[model samples]
Target chain A: MNVAVIGLGLIGGSLLQALEAAGHAVTGYDADPATRELAEKDGRNVAGSVAEAAAGAEIVALAVPLPVLPGVIAELAGYDGLITDVTSVKGPVRALGIRRFVGGHPMAGKETSGYAAADPALFDGCAWVLCLEPGETDLDDWLTAAALFTALGARVVPATAAEHDRAVAEISHVPHLLAAALARRLVGNPLAAALGAGSFRDGTRVAGTRAELIAAMCGGNATATREVLTAVIDDLRQRLDELSAADPVEALIPALREAGDARRAWPPKPGAAAEEPAGAEELLALGRAGGWVTAVSESRVTVRTMRPESDRITP
Target chain B: MNVAVIGLGLIGGSLLQALEAAGHAVTGYDADPATRELAEKDGRNVAGSVAEAAAGAEIVALAVPLPVLPGVIAELAGYDGLITDVTSVKGPVRALGIRRFVGGHPMAGKETSGYAAADPALFDGCAWVLCLEPGETDLDDWLTAAALFTALGARVVPATAAEHDRAVAEISHVPHLLAAALARRLVGNPLAAALGAGSFRDGTRVAGTRAELIAAMCGGNATATREVLTAVIDDLRQRLDELSAADPVEALIPALREAGDARRAWPPKPGAAAEEPAGAEELLALGRAGGWVTAVSESRVTVRTMRPESDRITP
Candidate 1:
């Protein structure tokens, strides 16, 4: 398949490389001449302009930042091609004046960006989210984009634009904001943070955020982000209030157990935590949940959390 | 060196295997006779009681829940041993307990726990935090625990319990509260959540928490946890209020930029905001302060403020 990728920075560069490596013809386009030059030097096909990139491409991957997608999409409206974006939030992409585009966001990443950090296996075994507008099915580029995602080993999930926005707001955006905000307090405190452990690192791993990109995302998706953050803050505040209301505050343990259970429920893969390896304690948290018997090792299994109230080490 | 592991559950069992692997004579102990029996069968030297575990042992690791640490400390009052705990929080542990114990928490973990998940490498390259009491230098066992942690590839830093607590609250526990509380809103909205993307997962990952544990942590550490949560909520509320203040919210993007910068300035890693490996776009929350540059490879990188402003991606 032939692909035209917009934005040529980290996501675009990686997508171009991945597509080309997978035996697909790929062309890259970016507004920044430097970025374009870098992509060209990297040996991927480079386009002089947006139109040239999408001229005859089967799939168009808009690797532009979310804030820039609308204008970029408007530029591509004249082209008749299957279009998708590697943007995080999907709602605005469709709601905005984008044309001939099916929203696709691949759940894969690394902290570092630019063409240098693009990993070929970035999207492998991850969820590739596809959001479609009501009348977007007939677009051939949408189908091609979905195929490209599948070829990259991502499970394509179809959703509406609003659904995508709200979902991301709830999960990705809110966490990033909280981490950033939380890390703010660490500014002055030395002793507290100097002895900072892994939990702090893992929790605030996303603390120092990029100003421009986040500002753009927040500015564009403020409504959804606000709603999601509001709900999250409320939930957390309520729990905290409940703890404050409790006598002797014995509720903290149960809270940890529940929090641990919840955290464990989500990531079933290895290398999920910031610094910890795949742990036997994850099963211990589950065992602490109830009679949920899980094998820690092939032979040395230990059960925990007999009932929800207490944790007994099962010999 | 001989090691005695108290509370033969996840941390305990893991300690047993880890200590054995590290060439330590490990004697495992648990209050539960059954757990002790299980430890005996699991191929570790199972001690009959907490005293037996601590008696003549070079190092004693209290791998129990936070709320129970005081009782464990009380039980250890007579024994002259170097003590450490694997509990996530340290403030209460130090305040409620005696000396001869170096408060060490390995910033290592998983969502799961128990003997099955136990591995020696769980502590590899992780931060094993050590909090010094008023007179930490006098304890002989302190050096033993520190050596054990150092051997595990963990960077040992001395800190106060309050410092450790606040740090963990900011980084680990607080994040858990955020994740769980955020997840709660989605519990009833599974359909919407089912359509959710990577951001949703990343944000609420800790939301699938252990109910009892969360309850306990919040209940017991309400003062510290509430303080942190309140700060977070208050900060957000203020931002929202400023955002939706009136018709002229001119300072919206600037405010977001400041917030993003705050996020970037925190945690001060090589690339703060850029470190987020998964999501829609490059989420630059705060300018440079937040260090929140998590590249969401899928969907949209949604950002929110109370105002109705949109970011203009630089052309």
Candidate 2:
């Protein structure tokens, strides 16, 4: 397989390294001259420009930041190869209507960024989401992309752009906003800041992320993020109302128990073995059911379903 | 100094060990016979009853759960010793009107509880809050408790019952509720659960805590927790509204930056040398300013104030 990864930042550089290490012929390109120079100096196949990278490549992965994505996508207009992206948000990219493009977002990252911090093992054992846009995405191209990520030891999750966006909004984008909001409350409250222990530290950890990056991710998925955030606000408001009740503690116990049960039951144990997905709908259904694709072929798709235990959170 | 620690749970047991390790004659007691046997078997001086532990002790520390606190306090009714508590919520305990009682809450804990998980060094470098009720607290007794915790390598922060409750609500109780709410959202959304990474994991870490414990902490500090949680909900609501705006990304940046600044500025660095607190009023002021007592004596109280450096979260 011939691969081209553009915008040689952490994800791009890592993909280039991982794909190359997986015996794929890889070429990488970055907008910054110094990054290209560094990759070239590191014995990587460094392309001078987007055209140079995409030329003669069977697959092109645009790993540029969200703001630069439209321009990069525009530059790949005439290219006939399979296209994918590593952006956190997928809805907007999917709306671009690019042929042979399967929007992707790997659920993996580090606190640090840039080519210097790239590691080939970054996506290992991580969920690499491939947006299987109904009626749009080419099955062959999607499978090729899934196979590439699977080869790098990633679990490929088949989802539509809308599903991907909503899921991430619930899991990633809204969590960032909530963290920021929680951290913001600490302002002018030095005592509270001082008293912050494990809960505050962990809850607000993502608030320490780069502001611009968080803004891009959350803001880009505005609709889904807003919906989820509103729901959270409503849930909290209900809890607040309960706090005013005659017996607030008693009123909160059931909700807390439910949450505790859900939390403790997370990352559900893997089921017996990989089962063949009937079709694309089944593949997407499996993903929504907390299952991941282990292998994809011309004839069948294999996935491991998560089995949630009933008595997991109970004492 | 002779100390009697009532309750042999994690905090109580750890306090017993830490105090004994600091060369204090510490005797421990618990309501559970099994816990008493375990403590006695572990070579700790375990008292069969609260009265036995309280007898011949100059300082009595109530390290019991919130529900058992009133009964424990009732048992110590006419004892003329310096009484202190390690309950998370101080307002209710302060309202108990126990003479010679000083409300205290140590901002340190482990995920696991019980006597078996006790560690002598648990309070090392942790903030041990000592409530100084403006008109009710005895200066000598307050100083004695402060000195004891200071000797255990804990930073003693002088706070009022209300102040401690509010601070913990902002930093601890409310965060617990938020984590629970976040975790609760994943109840049926397995895809979101599958996509959950560091942010979700960290944000929901405390949700995995004992539900009853969380309920007690949040509920015991109901008023303060509700206020803080309401504020958080409002902030999130405003962010949600911003997401509906034309330039949601631009609208959200300033707030995110502020939060990022606050989060990064956390835990402001320790200020200059330990300055002498003027009086009880000054000591309370230092605690509110995020300063902790390094030493306490008949003449002076030495504290190290946190110095938040400028340009911390800024690039």
Task: Return the TM-score for each candidate structure.
Answer: 0.60, 0.91
Q: Which ten residues in a row have the lowest lDDT in candidate 1 chain B?
A: B303-312
Where model 2 places Cα greater than 4 Å from the true spot, the runs are A42-49, A275-278, A298-315, B21-27, B37-49, B300-315
**Candidate 2 whole-model C-alpha lDDT, 0 to 1:** 0.84
Summarize candidate 2's per-residue lDDT along A213-274 as a digit string, tens digits. Answer: 88888889998998889888888988898788888888888889989998898766655444
Location of the lowest summed lDDT over 10 successive residues in candidate 2 chain A: A304-313
Top candidate when judged by DockQ against the true structure: 2
User: Global lDDT of each model?
Assistant: 0.60, 0.84
Per residue, candidate 1 scores C-alpha lDDT tens digits across B1-315 of 878888877667776887788888888887778777666776778877788778888778899887577788778877886777887777667766566677777777776876666777776655566665544434334445555766665544445566566656666666667666655544434324433445455556555555665556555566777778888888776555543544212434454455455444443332211223221122112211222111222222232211001122234
lDDT of 2 by residue, B1-315 (tens): 889999989999999999999999999999999999999999989888888899999999999877888888778876789999898888888888888887888888887899999999999989988999888998778888888898888888888988888899888888888898889888878878888877888888888888778877888899989888888888998898889889888889999999999999887776554456537888887777777787775574544433234312345
Count of backbone collisions within predicted model 2: 0
Instruction: Please state the i-RMS of candidate 2.
Output: 0.9
Clashing pairs in 2: none
